[model samples]
Target: MARLGIVALLAAFGLILTATSSPAASTLRAAAAEKNIVIGTAVATGPLAGETAYRTTVAREFNSLTAENAMKWDTVEPSPNSFNWSGGDAVVNFAAANGQRVYGHTLVWHSQAPSWVQNLSAADLLPAMRNHITKVMQHYSTVDS
Candidate 1:
């Protein structure tokens, strides 16, 4: 009966995963409202812009959204002077349209960073970090408010 128990446990686990992953309209928002908590999820800008189902589900279910990768160091500012805001803008615009709040994923992290950041010396690191923050903040300032 040990083998049968394992199979039953796996089936129950699968059901739990499916139930948690399934999207429901205002489910998160409703739950959060009851407890005065905010529900949020990490998302990619491109998918929300391209996929109607994803955009609709995210906008309807969660009250807050965060860009999964668009705002990261490697993604937004790849090189020294080159900054890309296309993906970031998409996320911001979508959030605005859906009346959803946006939380900045992260500013500094070891992972998903470019080589320039990885190779920075002690003296240069602060300056680079400041510049990155300044530029990113400036770009999102209008949308943030």
Candidate 2:
């Protein structure tokens, strides 16, 4: 019994020491709608017609709010052949405008990439990497509008 209490205290202490940011969206707001088992919709999305009405409620029975997914590095800059920002850019823009925080899914990962990326020569790889970073960051940096 005493050991269990000590473990719990240690866990709580670790949590306090870790840097934290604004709470997750789930904690800030309730799901826009309720849900059940089959289907659901985000609170952000209007209309609870069909399964969304039920599923969403169930999913949120214990939580609030939904999160937006903003990931598309490979699709955005596939193959080092071209750059595409439509997916991620639109997300960042929307979040910024709506006063929502946008969490980048990842800046770097060991897997999940287009075929061309894996075959790139060092010469081709280096410049492609730099260019992609510069463009993606630049696009978000000017989100003042």
Candidate 3:
């Protein structure tokens, strides 16, 4: 109840601020009100091969899905020539077919990286990272971000 009250107060303050704010205040207010209603689904379970059965199962349950830990730089682009879009593509396609939305996991983050990526020189690293983003975004950008 207290949390709800605080949220309500914050929302009221946001409205007041909008009224006194710049000319783009209405656009900002509407944007703020537009919810990023993302439904998250983890690819931790089911078949070890790829996002086959599990992907469909997740899509069946939720309207929109933000695949958890399914998308990462390394797996998307392991070596210079290797790129794996199967898992991530599955989730995105699933979301699209089901009239849902998708969220790309990340652009820059550690932990889920390939060994080759870890050993990259800064010069090489930049292009490689950019490639990963392009590939993933190309796969998922069909649904207007």
Candidate 4:
């Protein structure tokens, strides 16, 4: 009788472990989906392209992505009218491939603005900012947010 009780207890424990240890049960993306919430992380372009582990984690865990620095003004528009869309595009492409949404970080921030933007006179600042926003939005029109 004692032997049967021990076997039953062991089986119960095993069943509990199996229920909790499933990949879908443990993943943030899946949990968020259950609650209709969006879980996201900031992705750095360098590791995103170079590290398999980073990419795997991002794809497995998050439903949305925000570029760490790649979407910042300094990185995207280092020079006026000379945009570099590579870094931002990499993030968008990865998000699309993973069935994840892309969240645009910022188009205008005091900290990450390029030198030319920073040096713009008061009269020139608004137009430059407007232009920057227009161009960036047009480029990333496909992003979810």
Sort order, lDDT high to low: 4, 1, 3, 2
Model 3: per-residue lDDT, tens digit, 1-145? 3224334544665687677755433322233434544434344322323545544444443444554556676667777758777777766666677676665666557887778888789999898878877776776676344
Mind sharing the TM-score for model 3? 0.57
The true-versus-predicted C-alpha distance at residue 69 of model 1, in Å, is 0.6
lDDT for each candidate structure: 0.73, 0.45, 0.58, 0.82
lDDT tens string, model 1, 1-145?
3224334544554565567756533355665666777766677766677767677767766677778899998998899858998888888888888878887857778897777787789898888888988898988885432
Best by TM-score: 4
Candidate 4 has its poorest 10 consecutive residues by lDDT at 1-10
Off by over 4 Å in 4: 1-24
Best by lDDT: 4
When summed lDDT is taken over every stretch of 10 residues in candidate 2, the lowest stretch is: 39-48
Model 3 score (lDDT): 0.58
Q: Model 2, residue 132: what's the lDDT?
A: 68
lDDT of 4 at 141: 96
**Candidate 2: segments with Cα more than 4 A from true spot:** 1-70, 142-145
What does the lDDT read for residue 52 in candidate 4?
88
User: Which structure is stronger by TM-score: 2 or 4?
Assistant: 4
Q: After aligning candidate 2 to the native by TM-score, how far in Å is the CA of 82 from where it should be?
A: 1.9
